[model samples]
Target chain A: MSADRLIEAYLNELATAAEALPAERLTELIADMTTHIAEARADGATSEDDVRAVLQRLGDPRDIVEAATDGLVQVDVPPRFRLRDFGAVALLLIGPFALVIGWLAGVWLLWTSDRWTRGEKLLATLGWPIGYGVAVVCDWTSIPLGLTLAIAAAITVAPLIPLLKNGQPGRSATRTRLAGATPATSSNR
Target chain B: MVAEKVFTQLRRGTLEYCVLALLQGEERYGFDLVKELGEIDGMVTTEGTIYPLLARLRREGLVETSWRESESGPPRRYYRSTASGGQALADFTADWERFRTSVDAILRRGNEGRRK
Candidate 1:
């Protein structure tokens, strides 16, 4: 293949391998690699063999991507079966029956976790108790037992639906403040 | 493989300071830094690794970058060491001298032992 095509293919592989990287940072990395290749060509790397040699000297794309991510604080989201998730679910489920202590424990998990947003946490904190209250009222008013149970189940499951959606966690207030204090133009200095 | 592993470990430990030392002379773009480092035997094997290292250094306030228009191609981002980077390099240089001396002494002793 031609030099340009070879470079393109290599960059494509790198981009695919580094899909986890932030888009802006990835773009900057690709630009740097492109500049390096262009300079190499300018400095007597003309033939296909020369291009191959240049790419080889850059090492494997996987290794480059690994190095890029090495310093990051990786947040590996636990799977549904993990103790944390199970505990979160269990706490929310049994919160109403255990009174204030159980409910506060569930709320604490929601608020402290980086996984859920403030809005989601607030909804969860309020939703379970209110749902349980309604269910209790229905039970007292001679409502059908199955209907009361269904209402309780829906309320318990509602807050967890947000957890299933795939996306990055919303930044916490402290993180936002810290980012703001760092000058963005420092990179240009 | 063992030699390569040891070289890589050593490079990982010292390459960042080398970059700082280079920048102490003059501001250089990514390609310039890579080319200079690559000229030294076993200093840099993979040319691409320098870019990520530069990026990390920039993020850590050890280096700063500015874009300048090149006469030939598009604009190039030149990197220079920051004050913090200079301080770090100074500290590392002192530490490196002590460490190298200690290692050399041990190696010389071993050589004398083998000669006897």
Candidate 2:
């Protein structure tokens, strides 16, 4: 093959291999490779053999893509079920039955934490309190207070769904590493 | 195979610091920097990987980049180590000194046992 074709083929392979990379990152990688080739040419690599050598120095496209992907992996502090997180969830779940003071404490814990998002805090905070309030005011249930509270508790903790979806108690370290690295993959646009 | 894997790990661990060390007193464009790093034995097996590494270092606030017109061809993205990068390099250098000493001592002892 001609020198230019060889360079083109290598770059095409690189782009194909790195297809999983964010668009911006892929563009930058291609640009960098192209510039390196041009610079190598200017430095005296004119023959097809020299051009092939330059490409060889760039390594296999698949390996380059793999290295690039590895670099994109974000390292974040794993979300452990800390004592505070436990206390927040507990107080939010069962605290409402404790004359509302336990629930209020849970609300305090929930808001102060960085674990759950604002929407979660809003849902967890408002759901049980309002539902429990209505339960108290209606006084319509002959189902007995204990049973009603259990049902109410189940219904109110619906906000925990999002957390349950992601916050696996025994999540593998590799999976959690991928979890916190979302920003790199997400902010492509 | 195991030796190659260990070397790969070692290269990955120290490659960023090596880049940082190069950018200590001067800035270099991507091509210039990658070529320089490629000259080192086993420091950079894949030259293209340096671009991704540089991009990551930039994202991590360890290096800063800016574009400047090149006399030969297209505008080039030049990189220099940030203050944070310099500090990290200093910390790594100290740790590496101790680490190298310990590893060398262990290897030497192992070699002696084999010869005996």
Candidate 3:
């Protein structure tokens, strides 16, 4: 029932439910669970046991994780709305690639350049969707209204690709970066 | 109780093999797999944990899924391992046996040393 015990139970539940999740992601979920327990207990609960009790009442750990991660990553593109889904796919296509290109350019400029190159520093930041934008514009003019939305959807999804691509494990660079974002869970070691 | 010990035993190896083996027979709903693994003597994972692994496996083309209508409620995503998964599982199983015996021999040697 105590806060510590609540966290412990929540972590155990999350770890079990999220067994498929990577070590870093599991750690992140645990950290988030800690935050949830803290917030739930913040209403003047004196001890950790009260927090644990609150977690018990909140239902299964699977339920919590199921909800938290449910729609967060999903685009929820309706199948019936073929146009919209296409737009979403188009959006996804160009967004993150543009973001990564821009980010890499920024990093290189910051490290290599002796002085300000207006284009490298400024124009590169605009790279987040130059690819998707061009596609969207083409769709807008040529495609029907329904199809236009498909292009838009793709653009919208672009930003997530870089973050997701970065999170991929088995990549040496990814593992090194994951070391930073990872929380204090048993999986890290 | 089973889940915790299974997790500790996972170490860095054996996980992939177990997963492939589990899905080798038939497609299973995600939560069902998690629950099944939990009941098993050597797994300590939750649905939350399994989902991410499922995603990665799908990305890697090791498994595939389809949304099937359920009798009781909403459609459920069912996962089944691919042919590649079978080969991978076989390779992993063989490698694990080799490693396990090697480690067991080393430990036994240490115990023998202590007796001496």
Candidate 4:
């Protein structure tokens, strides 16, 4: 094959290998390689042998892309489940019995803590207070107090269903996907 | 296999500093820098990989690059050490010296023990 064709094929392979890179970074990377090849040709590397040697020295496209993406492969460290979070969940469930101030403290904990996501916090906040209010209203009406309490208890505990999965908070699926896609020991020896 | 792994790890640690060290004397285009690094025995396995490393150094503000007109070809991207890069190199130099001395002492003791 001609020297130009050889360079084209190398660059095509590089693009394919670098598919995971962000669009801007991939463009910059390709431009750098193109210029490198052009400079080599200008330096009298006109022969196919010389061009091949240049590409060889540049090494495998996969290795180059791996190097490009090395920093991006970092594993996201999730915040550890702490005693404060446990306390937050506890207050969320039982704090209202302490004087309603306890539940307010629990709401403060729920919002301030990072253990639960925004959606989870919202559910916990709305479900516990509103559900407890519904139960109080039922007590004031003709409905039996025992049945109303049971319904309130179920509603209050429902929010914990997602939080208690495997006894840990939910991890971001995007983080898990990224970590799985780029294993740290992926170097081709 | 073990020695090869050691060389790979060592290269990863020192290769960027070597690039920064080269740029300390003068600004050089990408091709020239890659060529020089490739010439050093066991220094670089793949010259193409240096582009990514260069991109990272630039991103971190350790190096600055500019496009310069080339007489024989397209404009070239020339790299030079930034103030931060120079400081990092100096810090690495001190740490490397201490690390090398410690490794040399341990290796020498190991050799002496084996000889006995």
Candidate 5:
């Protein structure tokens, strides 16, 4: 069989086998199988009859899924779920503190800009320090679990600081699919 | 952006039950479940994806598997829903209906608001 024909048979067997298989995953599996079959054919499995027989020996498609997902646990959290939940909880819990800090930060920058405008470069440049002081004082006062909350906020915001370091969002899903197919020891050993 | 997450969670919550439901009456192996899901208009998913889920259900003791030799090929694993799995599926169906109805209501409400 041609590589394409071999892949078609392979996928047909697969589709007929699993009633809940996702199409994306099936397409991925078919692409992999097709590539492998092409390579095998190139390696001198000359006849369609021979190739068909070889494919048959590779076990049923349904068995492949059963082996792959058996006992596997995956957490498919959407990108903005916990982040949104995080927003909601933070709003109820520490939203007031955040707003104050942001406002004070902007005010502090303004004062620093004023000092620069007045040519008081030596000592008046401490506007940032002043802002930090104000924010810390606010943190110490009303935010109940203020320090712990601030620490968590810093950590959470720190990830966003390096968002660009991660792969771009558009193709990330496809990349995830590919990475997940790190062939399990259950098969092709 | 918020909507994307809601849709994803909705799909995730129901997909597990859908898989179990398909296998309720008969003991089918992996690919059969994938094909069945794909045949549905908006329910298409891949077999490769379903395998991991099957493994999950088996591990959770919601489903069980055994080998059944196929005449066309080698022996295949056959999966059947367990009693607990069946019960869970029933609960899931209830939950799904509630979620669907509520979501539909919300969508309709939003549409009416837009029209107004």
Candidate 6:
């Protein structure tokens, strides 16, 4: 292939390898490589061999991408339909016969996950128990057992509605923090 | 291979400072810095890696960049050492000198002991 075609192919590979980079950063990286290639050509790298030598000095695209991404910590958002989430939901929804075990497992899932804040987790964990407690109290107060139980179940499940619908809780916090920091940084510029 | 790995580790820790040192005298564009660092043995294995490093340095406020029209061809982004970069380089240079002298002394003593 011609030297220009070879450089284009190398850049295409670099773009694919650096797909995870932020768009602006990826553009800058590509622009830098293009400038570097151009400068090399100006410095007498006319032949395909000379172009290859220049690219070889740049090393592998994968290695370059890895180096760029090194030390960056990304927040992991869990998928909507994880088995753990389903299991926790199932345990919470089950009748009070297995309520103790189900509540413990649900609480465990809530605490272990990075998806929810501690406050959200506490609300969800207390939801069913509080509902169940209210149901028992109503039952002792001469209220119809069936109606009280239904009301209790509804109350217990209320806090979990947001958790279920959102699938992830702390995303808002992350987004807001990032949004808040952006303006401050831009204002300094 | 082991020696090369060790050298790579050492270069990784020191390459940013070297870039800052290069920019101390004159502002250089990306390609210019890449070419200079690339020529140094064990300094930079990959020319592309320097671009990312430069981006990081820019983000960290160690280097400032400005776009200027080149004498020939398209505009180039020239990088110069910022005040913070200069101070960091000065501190690193002092630490490097002390560390190098200590290491050199130990190696010399080891050589003398072997000769005796």
lDDT of each: 0.77, 0.79, 0.54, 0.82, 0.54, 0.79
Looking at model 1 chain B, report the run of 10 residues with the lowest lDDT sum.
Answer: B1-10
Q: Model 2 chain B: which ten-residue window has the lowest total lDDT?
A: B52-61
Between 5 and 6, whose TM-score is larger?
Answer: 6
Question: lDDT per residue, candidate 5, A134-157, as tens digits?
Answer: 566667677566674565555434
Candidate 4 lDDT over A6-116, as tens digits, reads: 999999999988876767779999999999998888888989999999999899999998888865654545646477677777888888777788888888877876567
Query: Which docking class does model 2 fall in?
Result: incorrect
Error of 5 at B2 (Å): 14
Write candidate 2's Cα lDDT for B14-115 as tens digits.
898899899997999988998899888778888878888888788778899999998888888899999988988888888889999999999999999999
i-RMS for every candidate: 5.2, 5.8, 11.9, 6.1, 12.3, 5.2
Please provide, for model 1 over A41-119, each residue's C-alpha lDDT reduced to its tens digit, 9 standing for 90 to 100: 8878999999999999998988887777655554443333335544655677687677777767877776666666668
Model 6: colliding residue pairs: none
Return whichever of 4 and 6 wins on lDDT.
4
Q: Each model's DockQ?
A: 0.34, 0.22, 0.03, 0.31, 0.05, 0.23
Candidate 4, DockQ score (0 to 1): 0.31
Reference contacts preserved by each model: 0.55, 0.53, 0.00, 0.79, 0.09, 0.51
TM-score value, chain A, candidate 4: 0.47
TM-score of every candidate: 0.64, 0.61, 0.40, 0.63, 0.41, 0.64
Please tell me which model should have the higher DockQ, number 2 or number 5. 2
Kindly report which residue stretches of model 3 are placed more than 4 angstroms away from their true locations once superposed.
Answer: A1-189, B1-9, B45-47
Q: What is the DockQ of candidate 5?
A: 0.05
Task: Name the top DockQ candidate.
Answer: 1
Report the number of the highest-lDDT candidate. Answer: 4
Residues B45-108, candidate 4: write the lDDT tens digits.
9899999999888877788999989789899999999998898888888888999999999999
Q: Report the C-alpha lDDT of model 3 over A8-31, residue by residue, as the tens digit.
A: 766787677765444655675665
What is candidate 5's CA lDDT for residue A88? 30
